[model samples]
Target: MLDLLEADRAFVAENEAQILDLEAQITARQRWIDLLRDAQRAAKQRLSSYKYPVLTLPNEILGEIFMHFLPPYPDPPPLVGNLSPICLTHVCRRWRDVACKTPSLWRAIELHPSVHRLSNLGETLSLIAKWSARSGHSPLSIRMECRRQFDPISIFTSLIPHRARWEHLNLNFGSGSYIQTLDIDRPMPLLRSLTLTVWDAVGTPLPLLEVPLLRTVVINDQGSPSLVLPWSQLTSLTLRRTHPGACLSILREASQLLECRLHLWSQRTPLGGGAVVLPRLESLVFERDSEVCREFFESLVTPALRRLELPEAFLRPHDVETLKAYISKSGCTLQSLRVTALASLIQQILYRMAFRSIPTITFCE
Candidate 1:
């Protein structure tokens, strides 16, 4: 044991010199690394004094980036100093200039009637006009939602001047806004999309039924007898929490619809027995499944139907058969079908339908 201990000590002494040499080399390399790190940080600091790489990007690229920052279509974007596109301006003078000159950046104007005080109506109008002017000749997308009534004279006057440029408009009128009536006298030659959620619609409907280029319409109401849309021209339509009968009535006129979404509340009366043939309809989305929904699908003669979605609803085997028969009668090439049910029995049963075009089927509970 004593001899073994002596041998271990000798081995340790033999390696001590080599260990010191390795430690010295490590220290030297660490010093070089520290020096390089300091130099790299200094270079970075020097480069920071110049414009950023993104800032050097061309104004057109910046404009495209700014557009991406906005919410996608059918959604209203915020017009604030802190939020995107708007905040891009407050970054620096160059950014402000580019953003102001980029007409597309200023195209989507959202008016939050709650933000502006009633006393500052004139100032608000002036500000809106200034904002509108920045858009130049570009088409406009305007969204307005307010709880209180501002002087319509000032508000509409500011907005009306830009009517010729209006391509998309979204209006959400809340309670006590005293905005019961809406009228757009000018022809919307460029209008393509419109969404309206008007409560207490008092006077006549908006005078926008005859827009030549209007293609998309989305409305949420029980049924707006006052409002009339150019249904034949629409390619996409959405109606939520509305009567199924009313929807069928609209579908009767919306023969050109390519996509339709009906989120109806339970109906007391069945749809007036009629068929509406939508030859171009490709996609249909229903919020729930019921007798009314079944009947609605039965009424549709959509030769182009490809996608059908019925979320959170019960569909029995007979109903699935009815659906399969409808598809067969329409001669549509079904690509996708989505239905939600707690039980898997119906999904299995639906597989028995010998559809000519086997679709990618989904069952969600």
Candidate 2:
């Protein structure tokens, strides 16, 4: 052991001078690298200090320009593309900071749970939370659509706190959705427009949508008789896949409607002589496979009706006569008639009926 220790000491003694020289070289090179890094950082800073024309603009002016970068309202900007808000930050740090502070640029949120969730809901929720925060106090336009096997309960819960900020809410849930009861028990003060297209809605009706400022609504559902809303305040309504009897019931309460469109098949004809007088109705369009039957046709009294569109398949036996009677009873001077195609039969009928001044017929394909 003593001989081995002596041999190791002799080897260390010989290499000590070489090890010290290598350490000195390494320390000097490190010092040089540190100096080079400092110089590079200073040079970059000086280069950045050079005046660029756009960066000279004030923060407010930059904000205005950023706003122009966005598409029109109701059309959301993309999230990650070159034209997206995310790209605005890639230009420079100043633009990044400015965009981060501009709440309006990020106020629109559209979440497709089915498309995004690949068994990672926590990540999706994190993204939504961050995006919603950037909106700050601006009113929100939220669209939540789930088409497949995904439960959106956590996502909905994340948005519950921002209910008052909701200006427009669109929800289209699909198969295996966990939304059994959508409780809108909270009053949405800023909500103006709502579009709901629930395919397999829960048996229980959605909670009464207590929104005072709501003026326009589009529901693409079978029927919502139990759905409570301020029906009297609606000015424009468009419904798809609604029953005829249910349509009359809604129109009865929606006397304030100016423009209304219904696209659906006939379920139950309101054969009972019931009429719904829409005093303020101006534009009425019954498009697609809308069954404009006798009972439904005779029930409308739209004196202010200016533009009327009938469906392509709306040629029952007495449909034309019922339309004439409806026009006569309403006393509305027909200005324009919009139909899918102007058949010769309809033209001959119009001529034979001696319709008052064959009002400039227009075929709207």
Candidate 3:
């Protein structure tokens, strides 16, 4: 009888422990349910409060807002207009209509031969044609960058019909031979800015580009023959990793240049050797190479110069002193000066300027 009673007690103890465990699990599950319910309610309320209102603005206003997001240049990256379709259109029906109608959003047409294969070239050209048609009479910007595998001559010729309507043109040839027989005789009268990157051999008697209102020109060359700029109304010129021969060609072409950025490589010779004078130059930036700075100062005869930037690595004590003395002697109309040099060179410049309180000089370390 005692054994039976002990066995019953043991069974009851086991049952009690299991009951307690089950109760604890039930409590935990109930707490989780309550928390989830509260979270769901809070999320719904937040969603109700923060949801985008149905836009009642006119189509014109909505179109203008969408246009603001469109890049000023047509040949922006392929992803430029993707956001409008993904996010802008999904906002509301009104936004969707506005986004679809705003032709400027689709106006920028980029032909990247690297991203598209030869089999896909037809499709790419078709897409460009569709976008150009959608742009209507509005001036379009065309960016054509091709890899060595793709024929740039064929691609350029295909887009020749729309050349007259182009306001901005950016041609980047990576690894392909330079365009030898390009006929840009028909004037791009509205072209305002041009950026060309050449990588292969460019032969003699360069292409003649007639961009009447051209303002900005950027030339980046890896191994191409020197480019010749024939623009007259150029206000800004940027040369990056180019040969001295190319640099001279640019300076010779852009007679009315106002802003100049020269990024020289160590291997190439210095530019600005002859009587190349920038009559209306306001800002000059010399990056990476100090030899260019020495050569620039030697050849510079700018009367309307206002700002000058020197490379930090090349800003030696003697160079800074020479610059200061030159500024004082030349009666330079400099208002803002930025010297990217060492602290010691800055200290030397400040020490020299102790006598005369001229324009404020900014040191960028």
lDDT of the candidates, in the order given: 0.73, 0.74, 0.66
**Which number leads on lDDT?**
2
Ranked by lDDT, the better of candidates 1 and 2 is: 2
Q: What lDDT tens digits, residue by residue, belong to model 2 across residues 89-179?
A: 8888999999989998888777775544345677667767877888899999888876434447767778888988989887766621344
lDDT of 1 by residue, 166-227 (tens): 89987665532333333464588899988877655565454455589999988876224446
The sequence of per-residue lDDT tens digits that candidate 3 reaches over residues 101-172 is 777766667777555343555665666665666567777777787754556676677777877777888887
Give the least accurate 10-residue stretch of model 1, judged by summed lDDT.
174-183
Regions of candidate 2 where Cα sits further than 4 Å from its true position: 1-50, 79-83, 114-119, 147-150, 175-179, 223-226, 268-270, 315-321, 341-361
lDDT value for model 3: 0.66
**Model 1 clash pairs?**
none
RMSD of each: 11.6, 11.0, 9.2
Candidate 1 — which residues are off by over 4 angstroms?
A: 1-57, 73-76, 115-123, 149-156, 175-181, 289-293, 311-317, 345-356
Once superposed on the true structure, which residue ranges of model 3 sit more than 4 Å away at CA?
Answer: 1-55, 72-81, 84-97, 113-119, 149-154, 175-178, 221-227, 243-249, 267-274, 289-293, 312-317, 328-330, 343-358
